[model samples]
Target chain A: MARRSILGLFSDPDTTANAMDALRGAGYKDWELDILSGAPYPEGTFGEHMPSHHLFKFPLIGAACGLAVAILLTAGTQLAYPVVTGGKPILAIPAMAIICYEGTMLGAILFTVFGIIFESRLPRPRVGIYDKRITEGYIGIVVTSDETRVVQAEKTLKMAGAIEIKSGA
Target chain B: MHNGHNGEALAASPEEVTQDILRKHREFTPRFKALVAVLAVLFLLGVVGFIIRLQDGFEHRVKWGYYAAVVVYLLTTAQAAPMVAIAPRLAKANWRRPVSRAAEMFGVVGLFNLLLFIPLLFLLPSTEGRRTIWFDGPSMSPHIWDTLAMVFLVLCGLAMLWAGSLPDMAAARDHSSGRRQGLFAKLAMGWRGTDLQWFLIRHRIGALASLYFMFLVFTHFLIASDFVLGLVPGWKDSIFPAFQALSALQSSIATMLVTMFVLRKWCGYERYIGLEQFWALSKLLLATSLLWFYFWWSGFIIFWYGRQPVEQNVISLIISGPYLPIFFTTFILNFIIPLVLLIWNAVRRSILGPTVVGCSILVGTFFDRIRLYVSAFSIEDVTAHALTVVPPAHTPDIADILIIIGALSGAGLSYALATKVFPVVNIWEIKEYMLLRVQAAFHRMEVTILAKPE
Candidate 1:
């Protein structure tokens, strides 16, 4: 059984939501369906599955790593050089604080960017089964299933008011 | 009693918005080409001036004072312009939708600023025996650290710009043809407008914006402390860096306003950018203008009241001495002028009034930088406990004048080129703005209902 991708484009948000419902009602799994739109539609606008992400942890880990590195660098340099200025302590915590703060921020920012790229699954080698109309205010319900199931999915989409349906393997 | 003139409503369909915005790429008018040509010529002249100045090298810090002023001017204005976009977005302001891309487009100037900054690194003396944030950290402390901070700030700015423009890039990729389509496609990174992608991009933009703010403040602090305060002994004003950052905030709003006005007036984008944006930003501009005076006063009053020998010299060197004229101009242009003009509700609500104030602030900021950097750089002895003698105001030489013109032109050129690459107004954000709001009849009046999504 060959699996193919079917895209049902709708101009109206209500129609898109109805198509999503019809696809699910016609035995399509949530995993096999994806919704695309020009603007960021609020989650569950189409009654679609909301995926959870762990984006928060990336910055925490990065900040911790940066702080550890900064502490070591500041403390290690002080210990190695052991310069006494006006009988201040070897590790001048106050002086090190600025660099430490900057380092932590830099790490957090870099990792947050990385986390976005990773979490978003970006740099996608190809935009599979996409419609140019989706970038022009159209909502697309993309269904990837076996050929036999795709026909039923197309019927469901049309019956639920999809303006156009596109098929690709 | 509502103002009926909010320009035209965004009544265009999403596809129409995309086509209208992208149309600028195809229809590069003679005026635009002439503008680009003029900027390119000026930038080339700036390069020539740079070459002429390079002949002097880092041996004479005074000679490079104007150059330093230009660099900091760009830093505080162009580089800081993105904050207009960032701050409003963080607050979820509705009026920022059309002009957000205009603000973010200034990030492209950061690359040029970075290049101009490289020469100053050599011009800046070592932190040895000087009171600096670095203290006794390392031999190359300020140099290495400042460079790192600058690089990080520039990268963050570019990343924020790219992240904010990602969806627009996808629109460009879809609507464009030939080489442009290829470029936009690569830039878009196969963006398919999936739910997950949109979610991640939003988060990324927020995080980058937050970080850019922090980095901007830190960079201002470092530059102020190292380049200016550290050079003049017995001038330890903690509020100086904050003053610098605050003035930057004020100037950045002005920069955004000026750019927006240009887009609306000249670029035929009046339908998208309107009195609403100008009016909203005018209030902020007025607030920052008042705060600008407050910060300057907060720093100045200390020196004025204390009247110590060191504080007196510092004042004389910076304020009442040879730079007195420049100081007065800076004060009036940056504070008094904006205050007097923008204080009125009529003026604040009008497009021309804010744009004029913006121009005034820009000129004021330029003179302000000249007053600060040139005066600091004129100091012959960095190791002196206090300024024994005040150096006369260093006027711009031929090269300095050329560099100033060139630097300003370069920033403009970068922005104009970027407009061609990315849509001048954001496509998706504008569409989102439309989707989230509706005009409803309320009694005999109409009201706009805006949706706020968490």
Candidate 2:
């Protein structure tokens, strides 16, 4: 059995959202539908569970790794080649703390960027079923389902005031 | 003027504001050129002055406090510019769209500061030999670590500025012609405003803003430690670093106010930059000013009550000694003037009133830096038992004055040049915010209701 993808373009977010709900009610799973728009609408506009993002613990992990490296670099280097300054101990806690802080932030920033790229799934092999008009203030509802449900999906989108519908593969 | 009681009357469409900003961006003006020329001359003068200082040996210029003070002051002012972009976003204030691009342009000033640091580090006394908080390793010195941190921060500032400017570059690319179109297209990196692109842009901006905020506190702490606390003998106040950071925020807000006034008057941005923005910023400035006083008082009270001879001597040197005039002036300008004027609702609501307060804070910050760094620089380690503060043996030589003048001009020049290259307003942000903010009747009055995504 082959799957067919349908894209419904609507002028308003409300219409697109309604179409998304009707398609889901017709036995389409949450993962089979996506709402795409030029502007970032509030999440869960289509009543789907919010997409999980890896950004949650990415920066924290980065910070931990950074802290370890910073300790090794600051404390380890000072201990390896000791040159005490101003009667202070060779390994000054305060001086090392500054290095540690900077390293942690640097790591967090690096990881946050990496997490964004990973979550966005950018630079894909190809953009699928995307309309140029979506960037010009159109709301696009993408639905992939069994070929038998194609007509039903089109009817649902039209009922919700979709301006245009395109189906492929 | 649109009066209250009707929600429909006050709502502005996103299309209208975008067109207005784009029209302003396309227009070429000669006024910016004249300002740039003036700043360039001042910058050149500062460079010549620096060269002269370099020619004079360290023995003649050992009172390097004055040099370091000028460098740090300029860097602090430059650093504050980014907060004008970051703070409003973190706070989620909608009025930030108009002037944020202009403020972000100042990130380029970090390059100048980085270059200026070369002299500061070269002339700085060695860490192992001096009684400071810096540590030494086989191949690495404290100054090396300091430079590395500074380089990292400057790069971060530049990256944030560039990332924020990309969407505007795309706008410019689509709505322009000839050489400018190609330039903008190249800068845009083929942004088509897809859902994923917008998501990534928004996410990156938030992450960068948060990092920058934390970095501000961290960088200021390092600065306060290296240049002020580390140099000053018997002057150990744990609150000084936080206090310095608070002062930077206060001065930065003031700088933004002044910049906003200039933009509104000269760039025909009066419609975009409204009194509401100034009113909000004035409140922030006032709050920071009060906190500035508290931090100063926190340190002052402890030192005053301790009655320790060393602490008392350092306090007297900073207050009633040669630095007295500067110290008192900073207190008045940084705290008293801003506090009194900004406290009045009438003054805080007006644009000119806040701009005046900003000017006072800027002047005060300059003097405050001098009082702290110069006083520390003048003292000598004559014996193992103690070091006493004295008047700086060396005054501002011709080079020092020129360097200070140059730094200011350089910052202004860089900002002006940046405006010509990029839209001085964040066009996309304004459009996006316009979508969220709708006028609605609240009880009897019509007010703008900014819907929260949460």
Candidate 3:
């Protein structure tokens, strides 16, 4: 009873979404299917849960870390080697505040890219079922199911007018 | 370009749109060549002016802080190009599709801004006993903050542009051949257009756009504080940074409008960059212009009402001094011209009217910068904050004129080159908008509905 990964291609999003809804109605779990398109297709078009993303926290974390680093660079260095000037304190608050702001933004920007890379899980081995036509305005619906549900999925895809289908080991 | 997103595809297919864009990118017309050549000559003259000024030494060069101010203003205003790309996206404005890439490409001009700022570092007055922010420390100076802010802004702008353009790069990679294909493919970052990739790109764009918006305001604040406010004697206006930020917005909007007009007229992109884009942008320009006046009035009224001799001296130096004409011209161009022209619905809805208003604002902003920096730099009070009642104002020399021409050319040339390399229109964004936008009948009237499916 080996599970099969079937990639059904549709010419438009409506057919693809209908196919997905049909598959779900046939008792397939949300995790068993994925959708792919060239442009960013609106989420939930395929009647499945959108994959949750944790990339939002990266900026917040990076901002806090940046603020700390700014403190060390502006305050720590000044305290270690005090150079009095214009009756200003060794640790100038305004200058340090500017430095802190810069550091926070720097960290946020850096970590955001990192978060995207991590969450996308890019550069992974192309293990799942896929299609090249998806890049040329075709919609792809990838469904993985047990042997019994394979026929049901195929029927659902055909009824929904899948232009093509491919099976992956 | 106006396609019903949810129902039938608009007048053209995605493939056809892509072909149209690709054709435009490949063809570099004679008109484009002539424009670039003119800008190039102007830039060279400015460079020669800079060289001569540098050779004349700091004593003489200090007088040319006005030259530095001109360069800084032009370069800083060029940043509005990227803001044009980012702001519309954040607001989900459908009309932004055709022009976002053009706007984003201007971010590269920040490189020239950084290079032009190097000489200004040497020209800055020392901060030994002066009430400046540069604390005495090894390798610590106000220049560091300015440099850091400039570098960060440039990087953020570039990064945001790159992220937004990746899907388009992949599209190009799929359809091109030879070296172009290879380049696009590499830049595409191995995109296969999976749901995961799309999701990540959306979030990444949001993060970068937010960061860029924050940086735009913050960096302008730093530039205003370190360069202009810090130099002027007895000029302790808390609202100065807000004023400068508003001015940047106004100037940037003007620049964006001018660029859009050029693209639509010369590039034969009339159908794409139509009245809708101009109409939306004109309203924004009007709003920013009003805000700009409010901030200026706030600062001016405070100084005017105080009537303290020091504050009065500051006012005369700015408003009624030798730079009197420039001050008045700035008000007329930035505020009066725009206010008069843009208030009419007919003008705001038309291309010619907004373009005229935009040009006026740009000219006004240039003179405004001159008034701010020239008067402040000329005030050479090193101790006890003695305000100069009548600051010496000299007309621009040959070198000053050349430098200004060169800075203007430099910004134009860099943006033209960028357009050549990158797609001037965001094809992917256009496609996405096509998918999401629909025409519907509401209240027995035909209307457009933009669906946000999450």
After TM-score superposition, the amount by which residue A144's alpha carbon in candidate 2 deviates from its true location, in angstroms, is 9.6
Going through the candidates in the order shown, the clash numbers are 0, 0, 1
* Model 3 docking tier (incorrect/acceptable/medium/high): acceptable
Write out the backbone clash pairs for model 2. none
Candidate 1 deviant stretches above 4 angstroms = A1-3, B1-9
**Highest DockQ scorer:** 1
Ranking by TM-score: 1, 3, 2
TM-score of chain B of 1: 0.98
User: For model 3 chain B, where is the 10-residue window of minimal lDDT?
Assistant: B1-10
Best-fitting candidate, measured by lDDT? 1
Pairs clashing within candidate 1: none
Interface RMSD list for the candidates: 1.2, 3.7, 2.4
| Total clashes in model 2, counting residue pairs 3 or more apart in sequence or in different chains | 0
TM-score of 3: 0.89
Q: How high is the CA lDDT of each candidate model?
A: 0.88, 0.74, 0.78
Tens digits of per-residue lDDT for model 3, B366-423: 9988888777777665434757555678678788888888988888898888786678
TM-score versus the correct structure, for each prediction: 0.97, 0.85, 0.89
Query: Which candidate leads the pack in TM-score?
Result: 1
Question: What range of 10 consecutive residues in model 2 chain B has the weakest lDDT sum?
Answer: B1-10
